[model samples]
Target: MAATLFPDNPDFIKRPPFETDELRRCLTNYLDTPFEFDPSGARPLVGNYRWGVYAFFDYDDEPIYVGQTNEQLRTRIRRHLTNQRTDAVAMSVLDPFEVHDIEVWPLPQFQDVDPKKDRTAAMAARLHLDALERRITAQAITNSQFKAILNEKDPPPGELTVEVPPSTRGCIVSDRVREIRGHPDFRIARRALIMSRLAQVISERQVKGGLRRVMLTQAKRLEWLAARRFEATGGARTVPQEGDQDGEE
Candidate 1:
């Protein structure tokens, strides 16, 4: 009997991340091999199984979600099957024949004595999970589609107008800018601030090439801020503005 290519034996089933020719070949190779279970109750003898990435697909094979786990991949998928926190269950119900594909990637092996390496691997798992979630959200692919959907369902009403807060109105523009610039997610916040600032500058009849230069400089700074936020939160959160709670926009 031929041995499986995976770290674990043939009994350990994992779905490939995507359908590709290379992956099909790998699966064919795996299926051709005879089943073998490890007699030892120990870890894989050759490779690490500390991390894995998986994607949940609908009946049409459209990926609905992606995730990562550091524990046994089978156990993680089972939890998803039962858990209500994510859309996994609903998606499964919506398409009863939903297929889940998992791809296990071996992380750097760590001995029992090496806590630092283990911690690093754990952090990597968390980061991978975050990345998987972002990928599955399909933000880049779905944005235009969502907009079109919305357009078809409900046409645009009109331009959105947000009233400036009166309390903050008298506040010095420079001071307001400084406060926004100091935020941890400074870039987007700063850009919002600049937009507000530009409005203020225009209101004060102070538009100039110097102001444009300043805005561009702040735009670069805001770009850095946005990158940092993406690194921290995996994505940007829309800033809540005044009158937003009333469904103004």
Candidate 2:
């Protein structure tokens, strides 16, 4: 029996199978690239090897995200890291500025192997990259420290996957305790007062709005910081509440 071919339908095409070893080789080569730090905020995502997996790390060298891209990695990552308004780096979740370091697995070799004339190899490579990303994400989650990597959704061809816990949805404990505490601009002296005021504002408004969200975030950050500072300084001072702006003797 001969299969009927639809010429106008784009879905009809040759689907080639990639061997296990061939994929393994591609994955190995891509993964070989080491983690590179670009404090200057400059990335050379200008070449052929611009498609694959990327990871963001914080100042403490913690995993923040695990993602794969079919487009140019440079442009995609630049949007996340360089643009402040990028929705990719949600304030409720991960902040783009916190991305102190980036690591990539750009499979440039795939370009040559696939060439401009062939689409089959590129498609296969994308699938394999997704598989590799899932594998790395799963392994990292097993370790409590890395369980909080902020991947919005699981990659395709999902295999060996773990659910991002409800508690760890926006961020893990480390995000709250370490992110702000360890930042260079942490000024402990006046932060407690700020936290208290923010708490008070939230209490008064009692509405789930943008202003309230900001206040809540800062308050939590300051409260946590104040607690740590108090422990270090060995003296607990009164945290000012709504109207307690003036702390006196």
Candidate 3:
């Protein structure tokens, strides 16, 4: 009898590539990292943080999104990236594929603050979260070359100010995944697709001005990346036109 050409899985199901599995594992590992100050390792950063602000950074180390959640950080972030259920993901305001690094500032003091049980504490916790988010948002903008991140809406204005707390930052993408997705052309294509979808969303709905701002920022980022790639590849030497004449018109 001839040997089988390919071994069959016990469940008769195809498996994803090793890199794909590795990528997911990397993400989980990053999220599971013990909070920096937790010496006893009692809690993971994302899982234990009941109120927090998180930022997503793209391959170029540019802050692309900022968000605050009273919901468990793990639940909210997983929904955005893995589940693709958040409004930002659904509306294409953010592309999970572009996120390379994640930075989170967890508010552990508010971990037990329950809105229904203790309205005053909950309100104060919310204020702290808002202030932290605003600070992060400002930092993101200041660090950005374009002076803007891809957030569809600006962080809410508040006189309340808070110093940034201890934060945890990690790369969510595995090196294997980076090798496949790190090419500028790949990123440019992905950004263009997301931008197109965002534009479509704006056209279909009576969206706020903030959504349009996000589209503009996306366009700038796309253009900047494309230009870099083009120049790096030795930009078009000459135009192929009839008689080799410059088309001034």
Best by TM-score: 3
Per residue, candidate 2 scores C-alpha lDDT tens digits across 1-249 of 123556555455453323323323333333333323222344333222455666766555656577766666655655565443453343333454444455665554453544355678876666666676776566545542524455545557645343321110111123334444454345444344444554555567554554454454445544555566667655545445677668564
The TM-score measured for candidate 3 stands at 0.87
Q: Which 10 successive residues of model 1 have the least lDDT summed?
A: 164-173
The parts of candidate 3 lying over 4 Å away from their true place are 1-23, 38-44, 238-249
Q: What is candidate 3's local distance difference test score?
A: 0.85
Instruction: Give the Å error, residue 145, model 3.
Output: 0.6
On residues 37-153, what C-alpha lDDT tens digit does candidate 1 reach at each position? 223344452112334444443212233344555664445544554333433333222111123222232232222223345676565445544454344334322632221110001
lDDT of 3 by residue, 5-51 (tens): 43464444465566556656777887788886643456655656788
Sorted by lDDT (best first), the order is 3, 2, 1
Model 1 error, position 249 (Å)? 48
What root-mean-square deviation over C-alphas does model 1 reach?
25.6
How many clashes would you count in candidate 2?
0
Judge candidate 1 at residue 164 and give its lDDT.
Answer: 16
TM-scores, all candidates, are: 0.29, 0.48, 0.87
Please identify model 1 stretches exceeding 4 Å from their true place: 1-48, 82-96, 100-121, 136-249
